[model samples]
Target chain A: MLSAEHITVRYGRLTAVEDLSFRLREGEWLMLAGPNGAGKSSLIEAAARGVPCEGTFRWQGEDLRSLKPALLARRIGFLSQKNQVTYAYTVEEVVSLGRYAYRAGLFSGRDGDGGAAVERALEMTGLTALREASMLTLSGGETQRVFLAQVFAQEPRVLVLDEPANHLDLNYQKQIFSLIRRWLDQPGRAVLSVVHDLSLARRFGTHALLMDHGKGIARGPIDEVMTPELLRRVYGMDVHGWMRELLAPW
Target chain B: MTETRTLRRERFTPLTCLALTAALLLTMILCICVGSVRVSFSDTVTALWNGAFGLPIPEGIARNIILRVRLPRVLCVALCGAALSLCGAAMQGLLRNPLAEGSTLGVSSGAALGAILAVATGFTLPGFSFGGSMVLAMIFAFGSLVMILSLAWALDRSLETGSIILIGVIFTMFSSALISLIITFASDHTRTLSFWTMGSFSGVSYPHAGALGAALFLFGGVLLRFSPELNALSFGEDNARHIGVNVRRVKLILLITVSALIGVCVSIAGTVSFVGLIMPHIARMLVGPNHRRLLPASLFSGAIFLLLADLTARTLLSPIELPIGVVTSIVGAAAFVVIFYRTRKVRR
Candidate 1:
């Protein structure tokens, strides 16, 4: 289980995320939804320890601040929205980099299980066919899958993905969400993903948090968070008929 | 069959590097043997062996030239080459820029300025008897270190790799102008200072060879030890830090190592250009950017390249004996042009 208590993130003097608190139980699937600059990304980044924040976060019973980066990486796999790899590393090589925190140094070559782990990750992400391909040559959707494979290789307890569905098409997005759902179904696993598409979030997310102006507007089960009143209040869109049409299947 | 072919190709890289290293070493020995006074290879070998064994060989012109003059000069050339190349590789990794080299970072100029000051001051104390060359070398090396640190501090926010190169160029220009001004004012030492600026290994002695060799070995060892950290830094500092690398500390250590390496080379052999710039790039192209392979390959290839360049500089014009710097610049420029054209075509 992971919990954030009253987190505040400020960039210079401007508050990017203010007084945000949430908790995710084991095997839970949570989605963060907001418009551009709604502080969804900032909140996730703060939680991932990529940005500095004034708050107390705990994974299990231990303070998140006390854990070293390598230990933190072992417990939680973070996938940033900006996934730019500068080198011409092979797909397998790129994925293998996730094992960096697990290894002693960059070139220790001591982990005998590395090859097996890489193979398993490639199989899970359906990237076995592109394993030998250069990361520089991959398409956007394929690259995202490769990055997902990297995080999967870490075998972390919690997966934190910031805007994981940005460059993906509808089919690829569905594939990704299904993968996340399957991952969360495993024992002692949890997932927190930032998502934009309301329909997809409605279908996939077990719980949702809606943010507006650097503060949470609503947080609960998906049904409660996706109501017409809340949608109108947060997005200022007349989604009454749209909500009815969207929630019909659910 | 394909597996066998891949294995064969993989085996060839190390084999090729070894072969080149041996060939260059042999050529350097041969060049030393055959100077203005023609000493046969057999005679040269005998004199060298006899000298090594402390045998009472015939005291003549051949022995005198080989023992006192040619040996130290050849050793100095090899050491300078290796040191410059090592510095280049480290700079490239630290800056995370492919074009980054010792010269590109104003390290050579900084060292040069130090050497010039050492020469100008003519300061000779009981402990420091080497005069301006040694003092200037130390000063120049430290100057480069300061420049790199200041650049790192100033560009803390964005940390664009190109800004480092631009700053390096600015420093290089300033140092060169100051060196020129110094040369213009010096009386009888003007010719000597000018010769040093052009960079020659003609008059190297045992002490010069030993100093350069020691500095190169120490600094290069430190660089090789941190190859893993270098590989991590290539992904950018933020990513490296996220993966638990001490980015700032590593950068400072690398700066000091490269500065010291380049400093010793400039003080001993003057300012031999382009070996530091071109050798590491060639190594990267061959070894595919992994510093583990790239560092050693660059070191050996650089030494060989310089030894040959020095040989050509000495023998090409025969009696005239052109400066090694001129030869290196001409060769480096031509090779760079060819590489640029090929890369452009491939990209197109």
Candidate 2:
């Protein structure tokens, strides 16, 4: 389980996210949906320990504020909105970097079993075919999948993805979500993804957090949080009939 | 299967790189041995072996020629070349910019200015001599160090990699103006400072070679040991920090390492241009940008390139020897044009 208590993240004098509080249990998938400039990225960065915040966060009852980056990285994998790589490293090389925290000793010597982990991640992400290809040559969808392979390689307890599906096509979107679903099926793993696509949130999320003006306006199970009235109120659009048809199968 | 394949390729790259390095070393030895004085390969090898092992040799002019003159100059050329290239590779990795190098950062000019001041003022101290060009070189290097550190500190807040490169250009211009001002009112003895500005490997001696080789080897080892951190840094500071790298500490160490290497090279061989800037680029083109491969490759390639450039400088106008700096600039400019064209094509 992961919890953030009264997290207030500020940059200089500007408050990006204030008094944000949330929690997630194991085997759960939570989606954070917000309009542009809604501080979703900042909130996710704060949660990932990429930014400093004035509050306490706990992972499985341990205070994350005191955890070292190497320790935190092993337990929580973060995929930022922008993946900017300057080196000419191959896909395998990039994915293998996920194992850096696992390395031990002076040179961070490779673990004898890391090969198997990397191979498993490649297989899971359907990236085995492109393992040796240069990352510079990869298409947008393929690059996203490669990064997903890296996250899978990390084997983190908590998976935090910020706009993981932005550049991917519909097929890749489904593939990524299915992978997340598999991760969430594990007994002690939770996935928190920031997404802009409402349709994907409706299809994949078990719970939803609707945010606006740097605050959470709604947080509950998907059905209640994504109601027609709430959707109209949040998005300022007519969705009564649409919501009814969308929820019919559920 | 992929692991085995990648391992095999990885093994092959270093082996090939080593083989090329050895070949270059052999070429440098041959260049050193066969100079303006017609000395046979066997005689030159015998003289070198006798000198190295402290063995007795026949009392002849060949022994004097090899021992007194050629060896020290060759060693200086190779060390300076290797050190400059290695510094360039590290700078490129730290800045995450292909064009970043010791000369690009105004380190060379700053070091030159310091050296000039040392000469003009005759400031000699313990463990250091301000007697001649060597003192000037040391002072120039010290000045360069201060300038680079100050610029690095001023830009620490922004911490944007691009801004560092811009700051380097600005410093280069500022240092160049200072050098020009000093040159305008210089005495005859100081006017010879132009020789230091335009590099020459002509007056190299055993003591200079020893000092330079020691500095290069010590600092080069440190840079190579931190190769993995450099690899992480090329991805950007935030990402490197996220991966458990001490970004601030690494930056300071890297700057010191690069500056020291460049400073020592400029002190020993004047401001030899393009070896630091071009060798790393060439190494990257060959082995990609993994610093493990890039660093060693750049070192070897830089040594070979400069040694050959020195040969051309001495041999092109046989009796009237050209400055090694002139050869480097000419060769380096042409090489840069070619690389620029290739990069443009790749971008398109």
Best by DockQ: 2
Model 1 segments more than 4 A misplaced: A47-50, A61-65, A84-87, A105-109, A128-131, A169-185, A198-204, A238-250, B1-24, B30-61, B118-163, B183-198, B334-348
Best by TM-score: 2
The TM-score measured for candidate 1 stands at: 0.82
**Sliding window of 10 residues with minimal summed lDDT for model 2 chain B:** B130-139
DockQ of 2: 0.43
What interface RMSD do all candidates show, one decimal each? 4.4, 2.4
- Give a tens-digit lDDT track for model 2, residues B179-245: 6677666664354555556688887788878878887789898898777678767766655655556
Q: In candidate 1, what are the lDDT values of residues B149-209, reduced to their tens digit?
A: 4885597644444576677778878888888877777644533654555688877789888
What are the chain B TM-scores of all models? Answer: 0.85, 0.86
Error of 1 at B54 (Å): 4.8
Worst 10 residues of 1 chain A by lDDT: A106-115
Give per-residue CA lDDT, model 1, range A1-250, as digits (tens): 8998998999998898899999988877788988888899898888776689998889987889898777887788887666655445568665665665677764354245555666778899999889778776787788888878878877788988888888788888888888888878889998888988888788888899999888988998989998888888888886667767777999
lDDT of each: 0.76, 0.76
Give lDDT for model 1.
0.76
